[model samples]
Target chain A: MDICKRRLMKELSTAEKGLPSGLTLVSANDLTSWYIDITVDSNSLYQGQIYRLMFMYSPNYPMKVPNVQFVPDENRPIPIHPHIYANGHICLDILGDGWTPVQNTVSVCLSIQSMLAGNHTNERPPDNDSYVRSAPKYAQDSRFIYHDDSV
Target chain B: MPETETYHSETIYPVIASDIAMQGTKTIDSLNRLVDYSSLDYIDVPGHLLCPICQYPFVNPYTTKCGHTFCKECLIQALEPNVDLSVECRCPIDRRPLNRDYVEDIFPAPKIISNMVNDLVAYCPNKSRGCQFQDQRWLLQRHIKDVCDYALISCGGIKEDGSVCSQPTHRKFIMEERRIQRDYLLYGYSMLPPTNARLMYGSSNIHTKNNIKDSASSSESVETKDKSNSLKFDQPSKNNLHLNAIKDTKLYQKLASQDDMPLLELQEDIQIPCVHQESDCANGCGIKITKATKEAHNNIGCTKVMLSCEYCELQVAKPKLNLHFEQCPEMTISCSAKAYGCTWIGIRRDLEAEHQSKCHFIAMVPFLSKQDKKIELLEKENKSLRYHLDNISQSLANLPSFGNINRNDSVSSDSTTYSIETTESLGALPVLPVDLSMTNASISHMLMENDRLRADLDHLTTSLAELEMKQNTLFMQENFRNQEVMHSIKGMINTLRQQIHYILLEHRAFTTNSSNPVHIINQSSKVASTNPELLRRRLSDITRQDVKL
Candidate 1:
């Protein structure tokens, strides 16, 4: 198996045993992509809402940044935030230019969980309509200028 | 001896085989990335065997000062400053500080960890390629490369460069006679037609085909007698067909009486050439291994396989090295402004991000002063040109007769004419040019001469201005020097005045205080040519006479 698959297999097996509260692995059959379901553990705007996070790993995973977005499916809804767009594109730096290789699926999921837990605003990004309409298919493809990091 | 023999074979054989099998089935973990060893049976492994970073069995385990153990590679990666671009080094587990100064002090694999890792049974990494061999975890690489029939081997021909040819096309095969013997003993004897025919009739053909083996097996009958006797340790069943075929042969009955030996003993007798023994032995490490494990020794365990970094000259193991440029501190790298035409080359260590951050040409702002100098020169030229234009316009209005002159003569004159002087003397200058026109047939010729002189005067005045500026600076320097000299002279005059005033005072004291004792002592020194006491008495007598007077 490639390094990505081998590492994913390990991550999957570890997640199979148990994960942090409110964070659960939904589907990880594909080596290149995975879906993780996260529920805000604390009382917040997105407390009970189910949000699915889709991670598309490049061939050079752990070294290159992976494409992460809030994938709104039939059962899952996108988490409202100033940095997150309606099209599921996130302006968070870690998912963009500020990514560190040491970050893995667990860390990324937790970062997203904390991002949702800290949000008080129930709105999309300021330029949500224009950005989503012109956003690339992959979040990594867009040159996102991450200015605010509070949320 | 007979009673002990039964117990040994019955008890030890199964236990030894299973022990080897248990070891063979163990998985060899990779150090390149994180691996989950939790898939393994929890009861069979110790928690300490797992590396904290990869969560897999440690390969080259290391311990930090904090007592946290990790794979050597994982620790190195964690400690790399470029990984997170953070200046502070810290342990991944406890977030404790792991400064670079103490990173080298991290302990090597402990004795217990080394022993356990070496003892673990591991399947060949090439098991997917149909290798069935399993051995000690450390020996799997060799078994796969040297002994496994499925493992590809080099063509072994010498290249023109005197290096071994690296074409991995040849598959190692045991001798046909030996293969037959091994198959018969291990898999129950069977009478295959090819085997019977090769032994009975084709044996002569085999001897002629392989000249190297012809001497070893001189005759087919003699070869079968020796091979069958040595291979008869395993008792064949009554239903065996190969026994029926070879039993009637004369050598078969002679082999049946031979004593039995263990299969492992026979297998142990197989000697495989240490692939790099010839190359490595010249460097003083002459190691000969079994044919099954020679590949692993040369590939993994051989210290002779170290390669020097092209840039830094640091020795690195051949298999573990990636692109050295990424890690070599002394690698030569071009300046970050190479795209902007900077051609500096330096070691990676000396040129930090600061080098690019502070690069002058990259910023393109420092060179603006040079451009400013050029602009100043252009403005000076523009000022002179404006003065010349004003003179030309004023002259054109004054001399209406000058307009009819040939343009060719005016173009032939030098362009550097200083109109400043000529413009001031325009009244007299026009009269001279008009007189020259009367004498010359081409009136433009006189105008050209006048223009050339004016051009020379303009150039001369420009040079004169530069000289004047240099002279001004020189004059200022001399003036400063004179002022310093005058100040020192005034100080000397004051000192001379003070000395003259002191001398006058002393002279007055000698006149006014002649009777005084200290003045008499002074007079005695002046009169030292005479007797000293007499001079003092004479001076006192003179003072008394002067007082009487």
Candidate 2:
């Protein structure tokens, strides 16, 4: 097995054992992609709303960070945050340049959850309309400027 | 008893070893030579022993200056220059600045840490391949190299062209080859003339020769005692020769000295046939190769060696297998009209002609998909509408005046009464106060409460149905009684009319018979006055008859 797959399997087993409340592993049928359903805690501004996070792992995972993005379905929607675009592209450092091999699927989910929780305003990015119209299908393909640390 | 057992085993080991050696070159794939750590099943290794990067017990552990340990390979990969050179190398765990160029920053982990990780117990990587060996992590590599029957090793046989046989075989096969060479060398020395054997093997050869002669004489006597035992006697003599030869050449000493030596050094000129000479290909290719050309046969020549299509079971060469999959007849393919909401899925053969031509989704693509989207939207709207309507109705029913109006408008007034009674009964049922906080115990309690409430509702519904049925029967009975009363009244009116007709006829006859008109008038008046009482009696009798009928 490839090292990426092995590491993913380890992370998957640990996640399945238990996760912090509001984060759930929906499906991980293969090592390449996983679906996790995340619910913002009651204290958050977007309370009672659920969103899905889709993780696409390359064979070079850990060395290269997995592509993490929101997937909007009938029940789940892209969260309305200043750092989150309408196209489900998120501007988070850990998901981009700040990624480390130590941060696994669980930690990534928690970070996104906290990002949503810390926000007081329910709004999209300033360029949400324009960016959404021209954004790449994969969030990792587009370069994100991490300008805000307050969120 | 122990001594005899030892002697028996001592004689037996060599014979079996030689027999295995004579079987010759068996080939195995050397691709999976290294023990894969990720695949090993570790037994409860502590968290501290595990590498922070790979999250597995350390393999080639290295300690950084920050007092953190990681797998050497993981550290190297982590420190590798990024696509963007501006991003400096850093520790994966702490994000501390790391320099890949400086060797002093990271060094090999201490021996204790290495030993601790090595001491961790793990099952053989070949456990799936039927190797049951389980031991310390350090011993696993040696086990795979020296002892594992499933482990692949070089055949170590020389071809006629003076090339070393590159064919891989199991360790057992190589061990056997060494034993066969040992046996042949020993047997030749034992057959040598006494002076020649003495010169070749020195004084040690003389001692072994004496032992072999003694064993040979004892075996011959045993053979003569029973001709039937000759087959068994022959085995001991061969064992004696093997043992004597091994002792004379000091092969046993070499084997005993180095436990890790997988195969002993032997003369390079020995020719051995391929172990798989007459054996059928493991991939079920029926053709048999007669020489040590297994690598060529399996790698390129054999068509069945590679995987076949999981769907169609079509066996093709590995390079073209992926291409075959694109057009495999049995491969599952979706209809081209999938975008138009056609969910038809079948084999490639069917989808190519049958499903595509007949698909209604293709013909009505534009209109149908748009309608489908509209329908889906409408369905969502309809669902919300139904939910709102249910809420409105529930709220309206909660109002007393509205409930009364509903009861009045509905024909079944009894149903309203029954519903009121049911509500009263439901109110009488014990209501378990639910705790808002969800704990394990409270959740179970709530589940039980839900079950009890459902049972109460079920009982109430069944009883309500019964009451409704009774009310229907009562209404039907009331209607029958009203119809019977109306029929009886009609019969009484008809009898009264008949009585009036009879009285009029009598009066008419009397008037006609009388000659004086004034007397007739007076008579008629008297008769009129008397006739009423008689008519009244007759009216009562007729009513009685009607009542009896």
Worst window of 10 by summed lDDT in candidate 2 chain B: B9-18
Candidate 1, B394: how far from true, in Å?
99
Model 2, span B274-382: residue lDDT tens: 3432445545667775333445687777767667788988777765687898889999988768886789889989987788689887888878778988888667656
List the global CA lDDT of all models.
0.55, 0.65
Candidate 1 residues B1-549, lDDT tens each? 223433311111111211222443322212101112222223244766866555556666778787777766566655666566644556665656676446454777677876785566665544555666666665544444335555444333222233433444324422223334434433334243122212322222212222323422332343333344333334344324545544554334433444343322232222111222223222233664433344566676655667888888898866555656576778888776675577778887766745667677667644655676778866765665455555454443333233323353464333325333443344322335444333232333445566556566767888999999999999999999999778666656665565576467657667657668587566545556555676346435533443344
Would you estimate the TM-scores of all the predictions? 0.37, 0.48
* lDDT per residue (tens digit) for residues A108-141 in model 2: 9999999998998878999999999999999998
Clashing pairs in 1: B23-B121, B142-B296, B272-B291, B417-B455, B418-B458
